[model samples]
Target: MPVSPAYRPDPRFFDLGPDYADAVKAAEFPKHILRHRNDRAAAEVGLETLSDAEWIAHLGRFEPLPGQPGPIAMRYHGHQFRTYNPDLGDGRGFLAAQMRQVDASVDRPQATSARGASDRLRLMDLGTKGSGTTPWSRMGDGRLTLKGGVREVLAAAMLEAQGVPTSRALSLVETGEALERGDEPSPTRSAVLVRLSHSHVRFGTFQRAAYHQRADQIETLVEHVRALYHPQVQPGDAPGLLAAIVEASARLTARWIAAGFVHGVLNTDNLNVTGESFDYGPWRFLPHYEPGFTAAYFDQFGLYAFARQPEAVFWNLTQLAGCLKLVADAGPLTDALNGFGPAYIRHLRTAFLDRLGVKSLGEAADQRLVDTTLALLRDKGEAVRWEPLFFDWFGGFSSSARALSGPRGKVWQGEAFDAFRFALFEHEPECPERLENPVFARPDPEEMLIDEVEAIWAAIDADDDWSIFKSKLARIEAARTGYGLG
Candidate 1:
């Protein structure tokens, strides 16, 4: 069945043709065991009515839905871990299809300032991972461990609850196989993943064109981006478009920092052009506000460390700017690249305040509040954890008492909260009622520490028990609702 009237078929990426992608077949699994599905994300693209079995049929087995055909493996090159790699693309996955979604612009008016907003451009990409091998699969078998899928589901759900712009795990299916991995135990369970996001186009897509000296292809790709994603992009204004993307990346980066998220691999291919975070591999949520925290174990040099995320993002943006050099003026593109730092700093302060459900008291006051809040957390040190600090001080310092009653109250009510409390008095909360939730009054807010994630996984690995996983997801969902973030 067609998803909805809003599901307009736009096979735009194919216009770039053979050089850009290769047709591929999805691997058929012996069993299509459904692991997770996001009905909320489904309704955004008008596919909410899908049954569990139907989801597996489409996403699991790669059955083409109305207005879409077989999946195509997109081709591009990227800088993985800061080194140029020309062989990368959808090595284990492909863009299955694209569809337009219903608009909620009225619910997000600030979006208009960027491009006046458009219902037509509200798009979603159906992409898969570990479903099969493709032209881009270099030497490795295209398979995903079930544990990997589980981790992804948890990561996306948690990030969404914290209001990070991230891809949702629309469907995850156990594929009834065993896979070997260096990181996890050998012969782990296998699964296939379906992800829903704004777009899969990455900075490396342009890098490939520029590398091959295809100025014409670069222009074509830029125009496609303008028409499909950023309609407000003025003609011949490639630099302007890059500037807009920088602003978006900065906004999301700010949110990531605010949420204490560290995307272990910030490779060029992993950073989508639309600024939506996807391909959750080795992501981690910090236990405390430690800048030097590194998520990926092999990050020996710690290039994409927690605190240097802003720097890494700027570096990737410069690479995108470098690609634009073929079709746009170098000076303007450089200027756009230079603006990232300020944009990140500005949005970070505002995002920090907004996350607390507090109203902005202009730039100066907001900066002071954000700076003071983070400083207080650092000052509090090892005694407090990340989530609890935000929990106690949510809606600013007014919720302190409610925050303290929780399991960690004694530690949360430390002396550092004194300056933090005064910091809250200067501004009104955007939503005071959020503090009324029972979550605030509890002795402990739900925490997703590494130990907790491992415990949940251990239960599954031991007895195939999903009770703990389900309960944890439910608790995270409750936190999402209680905080009024969703």
Candidate 2:
């Protein structure tokens, strides 16, 4: 295989030794059927040139990448729904390989230089889902349903398109096997998914060290995170590191709100130190601005619901702060925690305005626009959809004529949106040319609701048809281009 010059293998996690992860072997499947491949993402890491057979050999068969270690199952303990579980770890997946790649800010904010240095090379991980069983599998089978893989791929694509920092779905291969799962119909097809992410070090990683009372290991882990992800902070400044994590988490949560995304499971293990949203399960995009909407059926109490996400994130940060307490003092850590609320409010205003495609008119005016928009959505209830609202009213008053003439125009004309309309007129559109994209001419914006997701899966499950799935992704790509959020 001809590896491109961009591929720079960096097996730094392997250097962390056995305390952080364990070398493991991948399971042999009956067959490997390539289902999806993210060439755009693959090109970023120089894996786009691989032949289909070669792609399967490495990602599906789990063959080690050049100059990289074999599959290593990461070890960590996390709190599930506020309940700590020591047995939690990489039960079905492992870190397959690591490499350095140029920053690919696809529909995301531009990367900034850390410590005033042009550090464009980002450390990325080629991690797997449903690859095989590991020491953390307990007694259950380490497998993933084909439907689950499809859902995650869709979730990642939509989230990325909406400018949310998330893991990119690199490859998804269907393994010829039937597995029984209680969550879905029994005897479902199985698959393996590979995700590309900046970092795989989760908050649970620190918690595991703290749980074992290893202050030395906690210190080592902090240094590792600082050197790799937060180089802007000074060495040995644990409090600064925590504060950076808090800021990132706050920004991510704010982005989620702007995108109308509900990350059904907000467990500590699911949140990494980089604050990029990954390991998506039962994720959903809101149809309206309902605060009580939840994606996971198991979340009976709405712990990780649409509105409580910020609270869930803060609680998780507290747990992470607890772990850091093993190495740092309490005063600075508390101060770091104190930053979450204000950071979230600021990021939320910015994210909300960005979605509306409007320029901010200072903090007070921006807050009013955000508040009025939410109030209008809540007042209208389920009468209005989420994405279309942003799509129709994009560019503030510049889009007034188009929005009033478009679908749901009557809803916008109603007295309920009067305050929002007045507030929107105060700001001008940031990029009026983006509205010229053909995707804006469509009757309704591209949405990934549950019924549509089920329909897409039904086509695949019943007749092995992937046309709808492929078409949906293409449409989403067009929307990404139209939004031009990056």
Using TM-score as the measure, the top candidate is: 2
Off-target runs (Cα >4 Å) in candidate 2 are: 103-120
Model 2, position 35, has a per-residue lDDT of 97
Per-residue CA lDDT of model 2 for 1-486, tens digit only, reads 545555667777888999999999999999899999999899887788889998999999988877777999999999999999999889999999887774545332222211223244688899999998999999868888999999999999998888889999999999999999887898999999999998999999999999999999999999999988998989999999999999999999999999999999999998898889999889999989999999999999999999999999999999999999998999999999999999999999999898899999999999999999998888888999888888889888888888889878888856659989988889989989988888888878888888999999999999999999999999888888889943
**Taking the tens digit of each residue's C-alpha lDDT, what string does model 1 give over 371-399?**
87888779877777777777767786577
- What lDDT does each candidate get? 0.82, 0.90
Clashes of each: 4, 0
- Relative to the true structure, candidate 2 reaches a TM of 0.96
Task: Estimate candidate 1's alpha-carbon lDDT, on a 0 to 1 scale.
Answer: 0.82
Instruction: Tell me which residue pairs clash in candidate 2.
Output: none
Q: Model 1: which residue pairs collide?
A: 406-442, 406-443, 407-443, 407-444
Local error of candidate 1 at 347, Å? 1.0
